[model samples]
Target: MKLPHPIQYQGSKRNLASQILQYFPLDIETLIEPFAGSAAISVAAAYNNYANKFIINDLNKPLLNLLELIIEHPNKISNNYEKIWNKQHINSVEHYFEIREKFNKSKDSSLFLYLMARCAKGAVRYNKSGEFNQSPDKRRKGTIPERMKKNIMGVSSLLKGKVKFKSEDYRLLINDISEKDLLYMDPPYQGVCSNRDSRYYSGIDHSEFVVFLEELNNKNISYIISYDGRLGDKKYGEPMPKHLNLEHIEINAGRSSQATLLGKKDITYESLYLSKALQKRIINDNQNTLIMKELKYA
Candidate 1:
């Protein structure tokens, strides 16, 4: 089976696969990913064959169409991605923006995926004019993984019919969700990554998110949310929030995205991993040292 998250998405939850799965109930009948970006959580969920039904969502229509094609024709996608993997061109800012704008206009999923890989910083940047504006990276490394196409196909097969893809307001989802369902929401980060200037993340509001969290707090259904951590870092070693009775964790959110905003604030610090019991365990173990220090200093 092709790996489901064939197309790379910014802020993918591949990192959260293990943690999210652990927190998820074993008896889930339906798996819902409200912010299904990289299929990180969804791909892993489908691969495990855990849920009898899967509900995947993202606001980007083009990205959704890519998912549609993946569901419909895996081999065709692999062949198209092959064309992308083999092609070469001058790598520059204008060249990237130009290529991306032109390519976005095309009705081709492989082209979209290829540009996403080749563009500047892998950020899906855009202009107010609705143009792709991320410059090209002259020094970018590696071809699209030699195994990328195969992986996508693998995921597609695993998700066959067990999956339902949708593009809708996450708030609207509460209408259909049941008390027993599990919802995974990895919305764009609060300050920088939220869907204001960013093209890829789309519009998810803080108020809306807070409401969603409140609903989760009120409902009997289980949920896990991935959002920005404080300290301008992903591993927030600070004490858990008093109100939520939450947990905080410190994990290397990968070395590449270690920037402050994504992390590259140029300072050294970390953010918290907000979750339920399992995160409490991970944080209580190793991060307690720093937590105590922060307590002493604060």
Candidate 2:
């Protein structure tokens, strides 16, 4: 079974995780994710027994804390989550805002997860002042508490003793990578989503991130990057430097949900960049030949 997370994330790799995992080295000692939003890839890796150990890190402190709570105390968090989720309130929107206010003040993980689940389209957005500003989803009743409880338990079980979660910058996490480690990075879409979505990551330095990629290249680290590929006629994401020697592969993600919500149907394709170390490891064979070709020129 696939590992499922309780909260919804904007750029989650849930659908494309299997495809992405195929590009990674099968006999990896450690699997590390620096910008793990919902850690969908890590969850998939753990569930499928892809690595000996998993390291999931994110810059989002509250979200990381919430994930930790689910790992350590799934039952307790689920009980509290059900209580807030099943409340027969006067107005759902007003009640959502009330919970949001409480979460902001107390930084409660359970309330934060509930807010994310009940938020509009599960779109994680923050204001210039670093406040959770997304509105409530009026069309749906959100995910059921029991269903989320099961997902939480599943993730916790798969990750037990084999996973480590941290709230840290991507650079710091990348610096800790060893030769036997495989890294998967899913950073923010700078120019792409900022036009439509609020800046989810506060004060992120894109140029510095490029420098980290250079460091990884110099060290010959095995890694894969999921970056913005295309939206209609426009290309998105930071343009990679040729010096990095990273192979590109595009994954068709069907229609953009955010664009659809805004009354437009635009096809979205995410670009996956495989580092030179991973590229050299992709051997020529009947089964792997097709995947290798897709990575060479895309």
Candidate 3:
């Protein structure tokens, strides 16, 4: 099924969502995303009925607000987006910069959506002063208003009453997690765009993230993390510690766009880490499946 993704975000797991979600248990009360970039996984889960409820949280307040508007007031956002998008046809480059400046000052959700739609490579980069600074994609205009409306409304219909939005630190959000909740994390890549990763408001400390994972394990929480991977021979970020007792799975994320542009063939493999608790649940579920097959054959 084609999932509705109104916002085009860099490092979104939209393409890899189905592969990641195959590991999800049959029943999930809530799916919590602490670093919900575009909320790709949550949207996919909702469309596929993998989770009954979702908590989409991000430290980026403007992005979170944009998502809220997309889900709550699709028509309002779509209409505002059409006005902004239509004006860009007269002078795409200049119009984009004007929208970006206004968004930086007002932090308006509608302006944020237009910026995200037209930004280069769908990458979100912020200045040190916390302003949207990514340049617009010059090759073409963003998604058409008609298609954008379709995506926005499609997403709203699926997630209208099923999602809760949060704009807080992940640590604070994780403190209230219960066993029934399945947390899916897609934190910013550690070494991407310099050591500090200007793409995010702040980069996560590698050591500190490891400690956070340890705490989740200690609590016996079920979780899945999409962290660190290899691009051909080069690897990005440090692998999860073995002491965490997590199961590591490599997902083929297809070719590297950068490599392809450079006339090289490099396949990207993203790392997917499953908590021991979730792994055990999968095993039991698999065992039951085999038993059911045996009973049917008998």
**For residues 1-298, could you state the per-residue lDDT of candidate 2 as single tens digits?**
5558777876689988888988877668889988788888888888787885888788778888877777777888889889998882568888898998888788788888888898887887777667788888987757898898998898878776777888877778766798778999887766633343474654356668779988888887889988768988779866677778889898878898778999988888889999988777655333477877889979
Candidates, ranked, TM-score: 3, 2, 1
- For residues 1-298, what per-residue lDDT tens digits would candidate 3 score against the true structure? 3689999988899999999999998768899999997999999999999986999998888889999999999999999999999999888999999999999899998999999899999998988888889999999899999999999999999899888899887888767787777999998776653455567866677777888888888888899999899999999878888999989999999998899999999999999999998898789889999999999999
Residue 112 of candidate 3: its Cα lDDT? 93
Model 2 whole-model lDDT (C-alpha atoms): 0.80
Worst 10 residues of 3 by lDDT: 189-198
Model 2 misplaced stretches (Cα beyond 4 Å): 192-197, 258-266, 284-298
Candidate 1 structure, TM-score to reference: 0.73
Residue 222 shift from truth in candidate 2, angstroms: 0.7
Taking the tens digit of each residue's C-alpha lDDT, what string does model 1 give over 172-238? 7887677556787777666543435655546556666676666665554456666645433333322
Whose TM-score is higher: candidate 2's or candidate 3's? 3
C-alpha TM-score for every candidate: 0.73, 0.88, 0.95
Give the distance in Å from residue 295's predicted Cα in candidate 1 to where it truly belongs.
Answer: 44
Q: How many backbone clashes does candidate 3 have?
A: 0
